[model samples]
Target: MSEFGQVLRGAFGPARVFEQRPLAPLTTFRVGGPADYLLETRSSDEIVDALELAGRHGVPVTLLGGGSNVLVSDAGVRGLVIRPRGGAIFELDEQHVRADAAVTINGLVRWTVLHGLGGLERWAGTPGTVGGATFGNAHFTGQLIGELVTGVHLVTRQGHECDVPVADMHFGYDRSRLQDTGEILLWATFRVERGDSDALRSTARASLAYRKRTQPLDLPSAGCVFRNPEPGRDVVPDGIPWSAGALIDRAGLKGTASGGARVSTVHGNFIVNEGGATAADIRALIDRCRSEVRRQFGVELREEIVCLGDAPVISRS
Candidate 1:
């Protein structure tokens, strides 16, 4: 074994750290290359340990949750990739619920509804973990997950555990301060109110149904490709919807294909891997969609799904 491998074993134990780990299977898109080193951490302590070790070695750290919102490069990711496996949920007090970052958004929704909570029912079919949701300010029709967050516990880049109030999160459309701070989300606390279980479940079911009808859920793809452009800044033709999907559809790019990746006919914003797609194929499709959208409408669409590894972002200009 190499000296570096011995060091990894020292920190995480024998065979716990996977070297040259293929990252494709871990993502919703099913298309990344590999991680130089991958560790599945069962608790926040392990995650912090990984961070500290990587920091000491000057290696980069990437936190992957349910892997729903990122596109990894075909060239793969460098340094350490940490996947948190913690999934604990607890009631902090009346009207407050605490969930570990690894808790699936759907699981959290179900638990909340089953426990007679109302606020999270609309996220019933959301993919990815609570940490991913909070990191990206995951949104549905009229709600962003950040709106309900009371606080979040995170490990900062300096290896300090701190609680950040909602006010410090700087939540906005598809954004949170975590993106800039290099903080690893440990857990988040949300505020909820009592509601009828049956009613909450009904709402959850309705959301699931809506997603089924409108999204191409049968295939592998990162959720939404782009953030909807602001209506005030980018005016669409009258009668045309101002949403990102509608804009892509109006640009006549639906069902477009690049290798194994194709723009979803069900939703113009989703680029699904029909089968055997590569990160390059998916990225080519994204570029095509963005270029065409710009040609048809004077709006520049921003991506909601983040690119991981060393993938080069297509110039928005």
Candidate 2:
């Protein structure tokens, strides 16, 4: 054990902290090596304290949100993994909702629609958490979380907490300043719009039905593997429409496999762990698909899935 790990164990206590914890169960991919140390924080204060301890001792810290869009390496992660508590909701203004970083995106969407909020209706069936959504600036059906984001509570590297306005934060397609900066998200507020309660419910149901029909929501896969590239820029001003999925599927990339990871037969863009999939397996499959797609269509695909750990390297280039 390193000096930082020892100090972390002492400061946070061994009971709540896990040593050499497997990260597979914590992620949607169900594949990854163990994290050196895993800290499950229940409150914002704990999150600040644990991260501060890691920083003081020169230990790296990786915040695990819903773990939906990430691919952890087979060799696992070094340093510490911080996972905060989930499913806490706070009511704000009449048309606003605040939620802890750990609440799943599906849960938030359901709550928003139940309360007559229409803006989040289209996102009702999306997987993952609000923090991941915000960090990735997630969007679907012509809406980005950036549009509804009003503010975020940030815990910086120095363990200082501040309320940040979304406007002051830079957001591009599926990216935000929070991702580059060493800041952990505690909570966020969305400026939702009020609508007829029954109508909102219907909209949510319709959206959910649409997702069931289109996406491979039931599979064990990160939502979309790639952010649509620049060529489909006309679909949404800030995002790529006529996505890589459409292109890949059109190129007959669906159900393609390199190893254990296979492009979902149900949805070409989703690379799934049918069973016993490894990080290397998924990377190989992703690269093969990207390469083949680029060869056939002359369009390159950008991965939306975030890779962690020392997983095998596969380049489409």
Candidate 3:
């Protein structure tokens, strides 16, 4: 073990510090090499301790949630990868609920419906944990998760634990201040309202059905690859509509393949792995879509997916 490994084991115990852990099984993309150190944390205190230990050892840290909306490099990640576990939800009141960061969005949605809470039903079929959703300000059916967040508990990279109000979150279209600050989300409190159970279930079912029909759910994917171009900031492609999927479809790149990665035929914004896709393959397809969209229509597509480690180079041919 190295100096950092020794310190980590000394502080957090040897059982918590794992070396050269495979990362593919931890992600939805099912691609990537391995993490040099993997720390499984069950609570906010453990997360803070892990971060403090890494800081003392001068070792870097990566926070992974439900493993959605990310593209891990084939070269793998160096340093420690902290995965928060032991999801627990606390009912603050009849109209408020607090949950750990590891709680899945789908699980939260289901829980809300079961309790007749009406705020997160729109994200019924969304994948990933509350931490990932809050990091990216996840949205579905015109509803962003950040809007319902009342408070966020996080540990800063500097090892300080603080509670951030929702207003300070700086939520925006597919973005939040957390993205820039590199803070590790621990838990969150959401404000909800009492609603009819049957009505909420109906809405949830409809949302799930819509995703099943429009999204390529049967295949492995990291969800939407690009954010829709903001209105008034960019010129809308003629006859292409003002959506990312529409623009990519109009560019005639749907189903385009690079190695094992291919543009999802059901949704142009998603790149699916057919069987044995590499990070390079996915990057190539993303580059093609961006280039073609920029060339044909004067709009620069922006990626929404987070790429970790060294980025793969895409070949132009």
For candidate 2, report its TM-score. 0.89
Candidate 1 local lDDT, 162-256, one digit each (tens): 99999999999888999888788999999989999999999999999999998999999998989988756666667778789998999999999
Compare candidates 1 and 2 on TM-score and give the better one. Answer: 1
Residue-by-residue lDDT tens digits, candidate 3, 1-317 = 77777777777789877788878788888877788888888788888888988887778999998888988888788899999886888889987899899899999988989988998887889999999999999999788889899999988999988999999999999999899999988999999899988999999999999999999998889999999999878888567778899999999999999988899999999999998888788888998999999998989999999987654544533
| Model 1 worst lDDT window (10 residues) | 308-317
What Cα-based lDDT does every candidate model obtain?
Answer: 0.88, 0.81, 0.88
TM-score for each candidate, following the candidate numbering: 0.95, 0.89, 0.95
Q: Between which residue pairs do clashes occur in model 3? A: none
User: CA lDDT of 212 in candidate 3?
Assistant: 96
TM-score of 3: 0.95
Candidate 2 Cα RMSD after full superposition onto the native fold (Å): 3.5
**What's the CA error at residue 238 for candidate 2, in Å?**
21
